[model samples]
Target: MESDLPIRKIIHVDMDAYYASVAQLDDPSLVGKPIAVGGGGTRGVISAASYEARTFGVRSAMSGALAKKLCPELIFVRTNFERYQELSEKIRAIFFEYTDLVEPLSLDEAYLDVTVNKKGNPSASMIAAEIREKIKARTGLNASAGISINKFIAKVASDINKPNGQKTVAPEDVLPFLETLDIKKFYGVGKVMKEKMYRHGIYTGADLKKKSVAFLQEHFGKSGAYYYDIVRGIHHSQVKPERTRKSLAAERTFSENISSEIFMLERLENIALEVERRLKKSKVAGRTITLKIKYRDFTLQTRSKTLPLYISSKELIMENVKDLLYQDEMRDSVRLLGISMSNLNNENPKKTKDISEKIIDVQLKLDF
Candidate 1:
């Protein structure tokens, strides 16, 4: 498989502690101190933590109370998303100077294809170094970079040296590099998968590579074949240039699960309003509204309806979602709720029809 595909030069660049670094950059007094960007309350979750805070086991997504317990001196600073967005845009502008094929994973990370760059740079590593330097010079922040033949390896390599460092995996060294990598370090191999692989005596990339494709497929289902190819340094995924968003969504996990319909409706209204705000910000409207619900036991369900016309108003979106919520019987205590709008513009009719028919195949995984 690796032989059949053309070799590509991919670079993964990640801002070091993006939100936390931004906070320190904006305020001189916060430098070199352990700080968290989030609400400092029992119910508040940390959005980011400075590297100093991480030394004490504090992390993003951890409850503020728990983070405070981990690092008593941790200072909580409210998140300024508008400022983060401004910096992210500036970084993207620097990336575009070298290559147009930049795929942003989040406000803090991106994958770039520099096989044929606008600047005619042949070395991806050089391009990555320049990009990181430009980001640091422009925003007063550091970035880490990884360069390799594919997106998967590049992304993994990016973490090898973090917080103002870069790593490059040469094409010739790709196989050996992957062979010794810990299974836990593999992309998409989470805690559950790691335990399952260890039980199967597969703790490293070399161990995973020893299994037959048929055996892997039999054990891991669809994801098994994926593991097999990646173990041999054979990822073929490309960097897709940024495109208009296909959908806009906002979701919230409750601090405590609720069984009351009144409480659920109130949460849905807030989610719908959030979605409406995002749609307006992007200057887009959609004809379809989807309602996603997750129960306490982790089972998930989604309901969607298509409208006769595109709508972006909060009231209209909430009206559709409310209908779907009441149409279904109360299953179990609800732990999370989300609302999303799709079918924006519908400029490509065939693609829209295909997506509509196969949309159920798209699985939504909860990060928390």
Candidate 2:
């Protein structure tokens, strides 16, 4: 089905190996060497790996011990979030120069709707090129961008030519681009979902397009209709600037698993204190308190309780956490523990209106 929606020029900008690159930039000796950030200790997990480390099969979230085994020469560095935030703000400032319709997905990437930009630039492709050049010039770091008709396609295109490169899928090429795309490359489709799609003979965008909405809905439930719409280039999600923070949390992974309740309570005390600090920083309180437990076997479970009143102090937060912690018997040795608060007092309800009702076509030519 051909969409009647107005076409939008969206660009997705993504930093290349942000944390690892930052480390390299600060210390000249670290450049051209394999480095892993935040994977120093025995229980440490890699937060980010340099491309050099990645070549040796190191990756983010991999255990430090395994990463060492993968590349014996891997150098581990501690995460400097304050430095990262400082650089991220600099990059975001460049984005605002073009348009205020910038939606930050994380510290390293964002979606920018440049349909109506400040510079009156007609070509989104040129806008993307200029933004990337500005980022490199100001920050001494490389960024890749994808330009397309909508957020979803733009996000996918950005990865096509990564590590200081870009790809632009024009208004006329959106359908063909998506049709030939590998199903696994579609946003939100993970390993499990990819296997599920493959079982149903859906391996590419073209295969997905052949399936009817009713057929997709019957098998994949609500996501089936989502897939059906996106394959036909019908994503209407806009670039939301003020994305709300839904929850706040703090967690730690232990060097060794502890099965004793006494030891668990000691760890909880520190975790709760961290959560309280974050809550106070955000100036928000929450009614729902959740305890996350990760077993040594890697299985995860969460227990939560909604309170009568919102609370932010460590003493008050711990009171509910202790109750939930002891409420259930120890299933197995715990490798990780976390506390998160939701139903934030500062949350504002948002209602999205469909912007696809108007029929318009995107500009076809690149002026730059």
Candidate 3:
């Protein structure tokens, strides 16, 4: 099966400090300084940080309080997602000039199937270089690319030479490259999984490759086989052109915790409106409404209700959000409130059915 697999030309492109770079490019004064594109106050979390800020151990998703402590001089700017989205569209257009089989992971990264490109460019490496050049010319931002025979290696390779760099892992070198790779560098392995793998003596791809597929499956369930195949350079997932967004919602963290029911309801009204606006922008509705609340003590609670029909109106979303807010008594002062809608109405049935069938087939063979 390994020898029979067809080789493909895949490239993963990732922007360098996308949001922070955009901020710097727009404002000359922000360049070469430690900056983060999110609130940097108590109860706030960073959405993105500049490379300079990263030197001080600041990172996206780190608490704003912690980020401030890490880099005392860190500058905070409000997130400009609309500006980011505009640039993202420009980047995607540049990608389509090379290939139509482009799968976007987010606003900042995407995988392109350049095996058969519109430009008739046989070298994926050259294609990646030209793409990066075009992006810099058009948007004045740097991007990184990883070229390989599959999406897994390409995505991982892109991280090797980041911030206006590129790497190519040819078919013959894929196994050797993967074997020496730290298990933590594997696509699906998280911090917890890394620790678990270390405890199990699976520190590198070489160590992971030594285990039998059945042994891995026994220990890690379905993902075990997935890990086993990826380590052997056997990922077959294609680069899908249209990536459907699963959910859309908006939320906010208050500078001060509020305990008033009326105040909370008022906050939710605006949040619901924002969610509805986003839904309209995306031209999609959702069947499930989820309300998330975080208390001052940091404990989290979520309430979700799925409706029979999908909805995308501010009034309908507010109705649900208000109901959820009052569903349970306020246990403690709330610091954050959010509402998200899922089970979107615009899912691609062909993609969903293909994935479902593949899962069933794998499960049938595994007999677990």
**Candidate number achieving the greatest TM-score relative to the actual structure:** 3
What's the ranking of the predictions by TM-score, best on top? 3, 2, 1
By TM-score, the better pick of 1 and 3 is: 3
Clashes by residue pair, model 2: none
For each candidate, what is the lDDT? 0.86, 0.91, 0.89
RMSD to the true structure for each prediction, in A, is: 7.4, 3.0, 5.6
Best by lDDT: 2
The C-alpha stretches of model 1 lying farther than 4 A from their native spots are 242-244, 252-270, 292-303, 325-337, 346-368
lDDT of 1 by residue, 1-368 (tens): 26565567789999999999999999989999999999476667899999999999999889899999989999999889889999999999998898777889989999987776788667788889989989989899999999987889999999999989999998788888998999999989999999999999999999999999998999899998899899888886667663557888998878789899899999999999889998998888999889999998979999999999999999999889889999889799998899999999744533322212222233422110
Q: Give the clashing residue pairs of candidate 3, or none.
A: none
Local accuracy of candidate 2 as per-residue lDDT tens digits, 56-130: 999998999999999999999989988999999999999999988889999999998888788988988899999
If both were scored by TM-score, which would come out higher, candidate 2 or candidate 3?
3
Q: What C-alpha lDDT, on a 0 to 100 scale, does residue 65 get in candidate 1?
A: 92
lDDT (Cα) of model 2: 0.91
Off-target runs (Cα >4 Å) in candidate 2 are 349-368
